[model samples]
Structure formats: structure tokens, C-alpha cells
Target: MAADPGPTHPPQHPVLVVGGPTASGKSGLALALADRADGVVINADSMQVYADLRVITARPSPADEAAAPHALYGIVPASMRMSAARWRQRALAEIDAAHAAGRLPIVVGGTGLYLRSLMQGLSDIPDIPADVRQAAMDLQAAIGSPALHARLASIDPVTAARLHPTDSQRLIRAWEVMQATGRPISAWQADPPRDVPAHLSFTTLVVEPPRAVLYARCDRRFLAMLEQGAEQEVAALLGQKLDPALPAMKALGVPEIAALIEGRMDRATATATAQQLTRNYAKRQMTWFRNQMPAALRLDAMELASGTAFTKFYDRIMADMTKNITKMG
Candidate 1:
């Protein structure tokens, strides 16, 4: 007999993250990778976590879930606000469970904040007092996001410049943090507390499709959502009379569909408006992933959507994982 040969590759990391902009075929790639790795597919998309807006959010369908175990999709009621901290706790539990069961954990979504919280941990800003939060809310209600953002710019230009003028939630958060801690939120984020355990390693892949191609997909996907009962989904959610301020109520396409349902807009107008918003959102997401995950593997989503290309991509991922593990060892 020939001499015994050593193993060819190192041990694989326990966690794999697939992230990108919307309509970048992340879900499909995650599903395929989970199947190949005997992994559980976990949701990291903020919108997809709400139970009420499945159709509008483009959550994985039942047929897809039937093919592999999926965690964290549609698990939270729309009435409840699921923060990134809350999601990180749930995701950690799921990851541990998957590991104990000898399965890989494949977390997939387009939510950059959630992924960031998991990988780099969250900022250690002190919790804002309820009174302080209420005060910030009052200020925002009185002056609006742009005016409040201008105020924030005076106090914390770094955070203000990073947030969009219309991003009310983050603006208010920055304002509240400053009020409570006498420090800018950006100052706190300069140092993050480790959330994930030190033992775990992650292999992150970011899908980057061409901007024009991604925009086209976003438009077509939104239209498909409408065709696949998105209107009814929105109507049902609106009927629940949940607070209009709820995050789920603000999901992409929900407001447009609700407007159509209420006769405030025609279907064509609603669809066009929603498509434009979706494309803009995808553009922002692409920029964020590009800036934040500089070291992550970058794959063109257009290629990954094709069968042959996806096979090559998967093989590359496996090889890279082995190489990463070897280096770490």
C-alpha cells in the first residue's frame, strides 16, 4: 500500500455569512450553500423577521423552507420592535444550537446593521433614559428629521454626515445618546463591545451585482411581490391597525401598497414609486456593504444567479474556508 496521506484542508469555520443588497440573489445562494454544507439557513434581514409582511418583504417561501431548516424568519410579530441587539441574542442561540447539532450556520440577509452587530459587536453607548428618549421624540416631532439632523450636525457632525437627512430613527438615536451621555454616538461606536464569542470564526461573502442590473432586479422583484399577494398582505396588515410608526409598517412596498389599497394612489403609480424606493435602498445597501466589509469575499451576484457560475462560486468558498482555517490554526 502507498504511504498514508495527510488531510488536504484545515477545519472549516462554524459560521458563514452571505450578505448583499436586496434582489442580489443572497437567499438563493444561502439556500444552496446550506444544503451543500448541511447547514441551517438563518435570517439576518430586518424586514423579513416580521410575521405580518412576508410577501412584501420577500422572505423565503414555504417551499424553500421545506428544503432546509431556516431560523429567525417571520418569528416576530409586527407590533413588536426587534432591535439588532435582540436579534443578535436570538442568532447566537441558533448558532450554538446548530453547532451542537453538528450543522453549519449560514446567516443570510441584506441588513448591514444586524450583520455588523454580530460580527463586530455593537457600540457601548449607555442606555438612554426613557424621559430623554421621549424628549428626543418630542424634538423630532416638532422640528422634523432634517431640522433635527441640522441640530445634530452642530453637535456631532460625524454621525450627522453619516446618516441620511431623512433617517429619523438614527437621528433621534444620536440626539438621545448625546443628551444622555454627553457624547456623540459616533464616539461610542469607535469602540465596540465583543458580542460574538472569541472561539467562533466567520467566513463572509458579499454579493455585488452591477448597479443597473441590481436596479432592474429590484424593480422586477417588487412587481413580482405585488403579483404574489403583496397587496393583500399590506391590506391585512393595515387592517390590524398596528401603529403606523412600527418598523414593519415601513417595510419596502408596504406603504405604497397600503396607499393603493386606500385609494390614495393607483396601482401603477404605487408600483413605480415602490420600485424607485427599492432601487435607492439597494444602492445604499451596496455602498454600505462595500465600505464596511472590505475584507469579505466579493462575488458578482449576476454570476452567482447562474447555475455554472454559482457552482464555481461555491467551490471557491469551500476552498477559501479551508485556507482561512489553516491560516488561523
Candidate 2:
């Protein structure tokens, strides 16, 4: 995705990235690929990176591990914020181990930033000055999104334009960037992009199902989670008083689930809210990949098993990798 032309030669080590929105069968597909190749599955999702979120985050289930080797799930603790740069280094090590053991590495999850970092080396954006970051965080903690946006509007309105009025974290980040660099964050991004080596040969799938059908699936999955102790999981995390700014606290179901816990909403209302948020997130995801990750092979989930889509899909990926390896030989 970077300006980098990428490797002229085929990657010596092969890897596969299986991605789609939540409840779109990404984990299932990763399991299938890993089973076929006797491979290791690595996590490429931001939420799944946290250890406290096994049930809530819908991380790889125990059955998934029994089906194939998996790395990087439930490793980071609840208190930390992980970035894509950290994940890429960890996944690269897992990829090396898989190859040495003659096992495949199937990277899976739906975080766009994670996949992009894997394919294009992350920009080494330096840390913002502590004073700047603290100022933004303090402002966010005090006056919230609108107030933060006012500050950003004065300095980096170009960057602020891309941020939704409710997108507090991003607005804070832009403000921090402005304070530290004295330049609009948008202007800084205009430089030619860096080329991080795309280390693995990969086949990516973008699962785009009919909106109605996918929405139904999201509702069903949320209800299924309710049956699976999702409420209890929310109660547990709420016990910790994690900062509202923390990513886990802001997962699709968290606020809704919290309301359920507080008796402000009934089970049905909370679950419905969660489902609506999930569907909206999926729509945003599809849009993002359409423009940002055009290389991903789009697959319609409506006719998943019985169509030329899946057949040609598998064949094209295999053939491309096979041709690359043969040429390498």
C-alpha cells in the first residue's frame, strides 16, 4: 500500500491474511486454511491483542487453537494500548517460526491498520512531547470531543475535517501532533509514503455480504454472545474501572452492555444497540477496504460455498503463489 514497489523476488517465507468484519467468518476461514496447511494462525486485530477480552473480543476460541497453531492472542494485558508496529514485529517472528517448522502462517482479523502495517512498514512517527499529549488528553478528559475539536479547528482544521465530531481520540491525536510539531497533521502526511518491506507472500479476502444478511448475522452473533456469558464478561471488565478512553471500554457492546449492567437498558435493548453498532462498523470497514486496500480479493458471503467466486478465488491465490515459488526455484 506504500509507494514501495515491494520485493522484486517472491517472498522466501509465505503467509496468508484472512480478514473481514466481525462475524463474517474470518476466524473460521483462518482455521480452515491453517488446517489444510498445518499452519500457525496469528492475530492481526487490535482488540484481540488484549488478554482480558477473550470472550468479549471474540478472540480465537479454544476449538480454533485445537484446529491449528495460533500466536499473539490474549497476550497483552488490559492496561496497554497496542499499535500495528508492535504486531508486525511479533507476526514476522511467528512467520519465521512457522516456516522453520514447515507450518503455514495464516494471519487473520479485520483491523485495517494491522494489515497495512504488515504489508507496508509503519511510518516511524516519533512520539509527541509529553506536555503536548498531556494537554490534549487533559482537554479530552475535561471538555470532551466538541471542546477538543475547537482547539484542533484553530490549529489543524484540515486534519480536524477528517475527524468526526464524536471521534475524540483522533481529535486529541491531531491536537497533540499540532502542539508538538507546530504543523497541521494533514500537511505532514503529504510527504511521499515510506516503503516498508512486504515480507510475506499473501492472499487477502474481503468478505462483503449483502447488508441485510450481514446485519442479521451481526444480530444473531450478539444474541449468541449473550448466551455465552457476554454479560458476565462486561460486568467483569466494568469492575476494573478502565479508563473510558481505553479501546476495550469502547468496543461495540461495552457501552450498551454497561447500560444493561446499570439497569438503564433491558437485555433486548442493549443487545440491539450492540448489533446496530456492529453493522455500522462493518459498513465502514467495507468502505475502507474498497478504497484503502484495493488489492484484497473481494468475496461475497451470500454464495460463499457454492459459486465460481470461491473456486476461482482459491485457484487464483494458489496459482499466483505457486508461480512465484516456481520462479524462485
Candidate 3:
């Protein structure tokens, strides 16, 4: 008999991460990879987690969902807020389930915070009292985020300096922590011994396309969304009368579309406004990915547009994974 050969690749599967700005085709890449690897597509986008405003949020269509196993998309109610800590917990569990099933876990999204929390672990901040939380929200609504940011700067200059003045959600959160715990959120973050998982290895693929291409895609996608009943989706979501501060209410197209529904803006104005916002958001996402994931493998968005490039990309990933496992052994 001929000499026996070793198994083709390593037995353990590394967790795969597909990350990029919105409309960069990361989702399509993820779907293709998942189909090939028998992997599960886990939601990492914060906006896509909401059960409401799916169309405006540009969540996976019914056909896309049916094409592969997906986890953690559209699971949270719009009325409640989801923290990165909560999302990390759920994501870790989903990853474990995928591994146990002998499938790759593809953590896919552009939410840098959620991905960071998953990799580095969250700060040890205690829960704020409901009254304290409500008070912070109320104060921001009354005085606006810039004003609240000024207040936070006095209490926690380090954290304040890091946040944008107009970022209402984080500004309110910082104030709530200070009021509830009498400690700066930044101080808690400096505490040692975080809860990072040691067992799993992660391989991240970041999609970076030319700015012109990405911006064009963002604009085109939003228009397609409008034609596909985004207006109705926004109307239904607004009908719920959820708090304006809720994350879902602030998703890329929701507020703009809500304005249209309420006669605050005409349809054309609303569409144009939403497209601009999406482009701005995509730019921010690109910046975040570039700054944060320095070690990730980068794929040009145009590269994934063709079938040949996708096959080549897949082979490159497999080759990299094999090299990593070989080094480990």
C-alpha cells in the first residue's frame, strides 16, 4: 500500500469575522463563505439587531436569511436598548454553538463596539438605576447632547474628551454612570482582569473599497430600500411611539423617513437626506475599521464583486488558516 497521508487541514476551526462598512458587500461575502464552510452568519451590526425597521436598517432579506443559517438578527425589541456587554454574551454563546455543530462561526457586521467588546471584554460598570437612567435621558432631551456633553466634561474629562459632543446616546450613558455609581465610566474601564475568552482564535477579514464606490453603493442601496417599502416600515415603527432616544429610532434612515411620514420633510428631501446620512455613516465605519483592526486581512470591495475573486479570496483564507494552525502545532 502507498504511504498514508496526514489529514488535509487542522481539526479545529477558527472563528471567522467579516467586517466592513455598510454596503461594502460584506454581507454577500459572508453569505458566500457561510454556504461554502457550513458556517453560521451571526449579526454584529447594532442596528440590525432590532426587530423593527428592518427595511430601513437594510437587514438581510427573507431570501437571504433562507439561504443560510443566521443568528442574532432582529432579535431585540425596538423599545429596549441593547448594550455591547449583552450582545457579547449572546454572540459568544452563538459562537460556541456553531463550533459544537462543527461549523464555522462568522461574526459579521460593521459595529466596531460590539466586535471590540467581544474581543477585549467589556468594562466592569454596574447597572445604573432606572431612575438615574431616565433622568439622564430626560436631561439630554431637555438640554440637548452638546449641553450634556459639557456637563460630562466637568465630571469625567477623560471619557468626555473621547466622545463626540453630539453623540447623545453615549453622553447620556456617561452621565447616568456618574450619577448612579459616583464613579467615572472611564475609571471602571481601567480596572484589570477583563473577561476575554482564551479558547478561540479569530481570523478577521475587512472589506475596504474605494471611497467613491462605497459612497455610491450606499446611496443606491438606500434608494432601493425606499422602493421596497422602507416608507411603510418607518411608518409602522413610528406608529409604535417608542422613545426617541432608543437606538432603533436613530438608525440610519429611520429618523429621516419618520420626518417624511410626519410632514416634516417632503419625500424627495427625506430620501436625499437619508442618502447623505448613510454615506456619512459609511465613511465613519470605514475609518473605524481601518483604525481598529490593523491586523485583519483586507479585501477590496471590487475584488468580491466577481466570482473568480471570491474563489480566490476563499482559497487565500483557507491557506492563511492552515498556516496559522501549522504554526500553532
Whole-model Cα lDDT of every candidate shown, in order: 0.87, 0.76, 0.87
Candidate 2: minimum summed lDDT over ten consecutive residues — where?
A: 191-200
TM-score of 3: 0.91
Clash totals, every prediction: 0, 1, 0
User: What tens digits encode model 3's per-residue C-alpha lDDT throughout 82-107?
Assistant: 99989999999999999999888999
* Candidate 1 whole-model C-alpha lDDT, 0 to 1: 0.87
Q: Give the per-residue lDDT digits (tens) of candidate 2, residues 180-280.
A: 87777677666544655545566566777777877788888888778888888889888998887777777778789899999999988887788888888
After TM-score superposition, what is the CA distance of residue 133 in candidate 2 from its true location, in Å?
2.7
Could you give candidate 1's per-residue lDDT for residues 1-329 as a string of tens digits? 99878655444456899999999988988998988889899999999999987889899999999999999999999998888889999998999899889998999999999999988788877767989988887888788889999999999999998887866777888999999999998998888575545556788999888888889999999989978999888888998998665688889888898999999999899999999989888988988998999899988765666778878888888787777666765
Model 3 weakest lDDT span, ten residues long: 6-15
